[model samples]
Target: MSTDGRSASDSTTASALESASFVRLVTKADGDGLAASGLVARALAARGTPFQVTVGRTVATRTERAQATTGGDGDLTLVVGSTDATNATRLDTDDRPATLAAVDHVRDLGETPDLVLALAGLVAAGVEPGAGESEWLIETARERGLVERRPGVAIPTADPVDGLAHSTRVSAPWSGDVDATHETLSDAIGADLEAETDRADDADASGTTLEHTDHRALGSVVALDAVSAEAATAAAAESIQRVLKPYATPDAPFETVGGYADVLEATAQTEPGTGAALAMGHDAREPALAVWREYGRRAHNALEAASTGRYDGLFVVGIDDGPVEAVAALSTAFRSPEPLVLAVGAGEAALATREGTLPPLEGVARDLESVLEGTGDATDQGVTYDVTASGRRGYLQYDPAVDETTIIETVREYQ
Candidate 1:
């Protein structure tokens, strides 16, 4: 084994997949998981390997493990990006299959262990990248126009109106309020906001979209709004402008990879099956986009109505009913100095922190698991815990039996 937990060399190849009668691919329901699993499924198909994709929380349960192995002999189960899984062909750092051992090497080189890197490893293993192929997933995505390297605002869509209205990043007070959105846009862009919208509409009608200059102009106004917001910190506002790699394509469901990730994440918030279908490259784009838009509205509205209490190192926002993941993610656009803990009644809560925060959330979540009588795992710089004691077995779900006050106190203690 090499430093950073990867084997120094790999001998695994497509032969492992080719010999299998069937392949079951399993991964988390989040964006990276979906993208990685989908790419793997595509590669498996290209190799004539029959495969089915399954998505779940970060950790695979005992039942999931059992089902993963239920296929007849000669069938293979491939698990990707799960924290703790067994009885399968593990492609993550834990078991360090040669197929993905390079993931650690890439990590050691300071790159993310994302879908593209996963594909790069697979490509090295003689797996074809499907028709119209390239050796690397990034190259393939670029060749197919699945992603463009143009830098722009982090908003997934080009339309300033829709971007502002549905954006979780800017955390504009007008979120989910169309009139408020229009008013804010008018304030930032002057009467030009209406003219720009009309022009964009005309462009859409003419099969020509707005220019990059127009996007940058609108993005500038958004940057100003974020910097000027009282709730925003300098660091957070800086992060907003820093995320310039706007990944999008007209052929894809959402405007950008960020956008697609948003929609997939929101869909997974309540409907894992729907999220998994979209993630596995199934033709579920329209319904998934619809789910994201609706989820955005509810989550933003919840953020607006939340009863916020600021602590030394945490901000507790209590909401009635909304997607906990959405609430946590959207609220981060404002860039609070402290991590945000959002609670839904006493039955559900999530802790969301900006990436690279202190007291790494995995440790924090493990600590809270004991106190909350719950099981939790770190996903996207934060943790989602379900209070198993309450008999709930879903993401962001805790037990009302734990009570609201105790949850708050426990979080406070851990924070």
Candidate 2:
């Protein structure tokens, strides 16, 4: 990118980079008053362009100011606050001189730009407009070689967490020996847990249910028919984890380029999980970020749904490896009241909850691990929730006719 107001890329990357869309930072006060950027932001997003807000000029937060002012390639910061000469002068830069309003550019073709909400927000913030202030403001900026028309900038794409990704999110990382675990869970939950593995994935209603990609093993279990609730939950968890953990792609370690663990580590909004493999590298980069975004987005959706009473709770898994990042969505009917979704990585037990963030406390994780080993119920402690499915018996029938969609659906129900 050049120092001139117009952003230009290197010769090798220009053409592809030109397709990247930048941001027009907006403020809450003036944001509701403007229309162009919201429309433009949607247009860009429809085509896969990424945009985010960074508070540059605001009276609200100190942290926001520090982060926004140092904005770079993809950000075009606009402060909708006080516009006294000193404030305005502080906002002046080669690319993003602060403006009291959003500038309207010719969306269709080459033409000059138009300024919107000129000094309106500034007045609201108590900056009195002088005689001929608006015109004079534009004139002085023009003299300083700054124009109201801002160009689109390029977004940074090589992060696991920033943009679109292709990696799949796996809810149950390993569903090992589906049958054995199914029988064990059946005895554990004391009810005939639904055999979710029937490969009924035929799109044309072929009814083929077996799928190799996603090993969605079992569905749900109930304590109603259980002879011994504690024993059932323990059996179910042991049987499932015993098979699933060893079945993971042993060739791809957690830190490997396309490994699910690596993607999780890179794109994670908070710190890495405590169970993160010690030998794994923290630096994991992919060419695109679609996978990470989808995973995080799904996780966020699951969290919000439970919190908002959209659903009582949810249990599911996601697994992705490059090529347009895979996503697993959960519907309302399949949610669980007490979800026990766990994230598995390299033989470690790391759980993330609203209260317990990633890299859960070692002692807490150990205690929960023990609880899962016993009856599946305990008090919530730190980040680990009480294990709800322990020693539970359920039935899962696996067959060869399963398809991708079916497998995904089964996994959600099982979790």
Candidate 3:
């Protein structure tokens, strides 16, 4: 019979039986039992047999309840759980001498199972089957014409101390010297037993050799124990400044390209210039100074060199009305080797202006300072500046620097 409790009509029956879903018996999350359950599921799948497998902590009262519910419809149910003999015995609800006796109760309920696969440890731990019980199980199998014994197949052997082993040398029963029937039953059971054995071995191997590694190593950057956040920040800042210095010039022009006005505003806060720094509104505008600083730093090295001397010509041209002009200004200002900044301040006109030539760095820087000081609004915004020197280009990005309390206050306000 196949695992679905149907008679075999072809050689494939054995395969079908092997693949049919069966109840998995496990004990305490035993790896062996889990693997065995998987093997059983795979075997059923291979044979195109319909089956369902359930897993649980132990073959206890809960498992029995599940089995009663799921097994009545002739569906195979495998329970995997802890395999302690005492625990198994306590869980058995059947009157038979051992936990395997539950098999008979299931069959008696008009559902004859194709097989009963008990994990070795579970069987070893359960109550021993008495002689009467053994004979009764075999007789039931014979009367039902289900093979109880087959030659050349290694049936589960009980340790001498095991009650079931002493009671029965189990075998599949079939009538009339039917070689095919014997072969079918033997092959089916043998495959299942072998798979279980293999799984158990694999579990043992894994337990013995497995090693654990940090999961974060898969993607995160590792830092040395000695590294501190402040130190790292300083290092990064130093590197950026070094890169920026080469492209710096004393007198660079600020172009009216690429929203150069904003760049000018940013530079005014950070970059020193010949002219008095322009003041911005201190109320809501103070927070935005960081943005201006970033823009200045980034475009600082790209300023176009203008007139030299203590009157270094660094200019910042703001496109308060024309966008095209702003972009062009920014582009030109950024191409210089001095601090030429630009600020394309808020307004539609600024965005509409056409591109224009860059001015000197001193003029750009001066204008930047003017705009930053001129606008009193302090809002946090990101600003970007690009610098190129000796064919190498880099970016300087800035965000408003604030303390934890200020950030928390901002977040709470938003919330």
Candidate 4:
């Protein structure tokens, strides 16, 4: 149950979905959103219910579109990937990941157990599988085909070459460099690459069945190399454990469920339309894969090129190119004990805490507004802001004259 004492069971959501003449699944374009949409689609299909799925940027936009289409009639609308809902049923699991709740929704609707969907939800959720509800979910997925009981080194694919080449957790020199990745893997694990690739190829040729033992052992070795390739901070160890066990489905485009989620996230960051299509079960793999690979390459380059400086309890990074949002997260994942402040271009900055222990940005924004006399944009994790002599439209407006260092120091003072 949630801390609010709300039941996690999908009985109510299932009943609502079953009785509605038509359903609309509104989700974000991210990995979790896509996974949630797919799960809902499956459940509705099993129930023989008609539904339409759409992707949006925020809860308001998603529900607004749903309402516009449904005309505020009898159609039921469900919001996924976010806790906030308006005139719709929210399918998020304790604000963790919507996919978990979606999995339960499918079963509640009497759909048969789907191993791939369950495994994907677990991977996307990125929570410990030993926990109460997660434990039950993982056990069911394992009974069907899940290989590992817990998360290991998160190299998304069974093929070490492909996985390492696309890994952003590790820095350059090996990331996006297939030869370097291969050499690193060969030196670290000393495995027979030819034989292993042959086996993986055979598995792909015959079917999508994963070689459980081989994947487990190989994933460990690759994970070790990934840690060594980057600074071996405590955050590196924590990030290493973020990888879910690799599982595959013949119906999906990627080899492992981890790979599927990875690519989806990458595509979401780069080519959102393709990402949404792939999430909604559209046939756009080739273009999506291209975008995912390029996104990985650019993200690695950005991380490598970022200039890092230290404050008392903050590590600030400045990125001149590439995806600032994604790099901010990557920097946080590899951060030290100090919180990370990402300086995006010259106008705005974002702050992130290790493991997201930072309190809501609302209070911070309020304090900053009083002190700096500027506007601030707050999110659950961090804030986007710039100090203006006079607040523009009561919102923080970027002033290029105000340097990033000033913003970082102001944010730190409030923290």
Which candidate tops TM-score?
A: 4
Per-residue lDDT tens digits for candidate 4, residues 1-415, read: 2223235546777788778778888776556667778777866776777888777644345556655664446578887744234567876643456666666667667775455544554554454444545666656655655544433334445566656576654443566666666676667556566544422433222111234325566557655655665544567666766553544443546666666667766765467678766665668776776676677777777767778887776677776666554565566666444655444544444445563344334454455445445434433333233111111000122444445655565557655
lDDT of 3 by residue, 1-415 (tens): 1122222332232332444344333211221222233333434444455644333322233344453543433343333332223312121222222223223333433343322122121222121212333344334434554322211211111110110111111111211122322243334322221222211332111111001212122001112111222213222222222111111111112111111123222322233121012111113222222333233323322222222111132222323222222232333222222232223323210111112222222232233333444554223332223211111111222233322222222212311
lDDT of each: 0.53, 0.26, 0.25, 0.57
Clashes of 2: 60
RMSD for all candidates, in order, please: 8.4, 22.6, 37.1, 7.0
Q: What is the lDDT of candidate 3?
A: 0.25
Clashes of 1: 1
Tell how far residue 177 is off in model 4, in angstroms.
2.5
lDDT of 2 by residue, 375-396 (tens): 4432332122111011111111
Stretches of candidate 4 exceeding 4 Å from the true structure: 1-12, 59-72, 83-85, 146-153, 169-173, 186-221, 244-253, 282-285, 335-352, 362-414
Query: Residue by residue across 1-415, what tens digits does model 1's lDDT show?
Result: 2344433332242335556788877665444445556555655555566888776654534226535468688787766554444467655443332334434323333444344324423322223333122234556567766557555554445455655566554565566765676666666545344434322533221111234235555566666666777666655575565444455555665565555556655665556667767655678865665566677778878877777777776666777877765565555546456654444454566655554332333444565556654434323333343211111112444445555565667566644
Give every collision pair in model 1: 247-257
lDDT of model number 1? 0.53
Q: State, as a TM-score between 0 and 1, how close model 3 is to the true structure.
A: 0.18
Instruction: lDDT for model 4, please.
Output: 0.57
Error of 4 at 100 (Å): 2.0
Q: After superposition, how far is residue 376 of candidate 2 from its true place, in Å?
A: 35
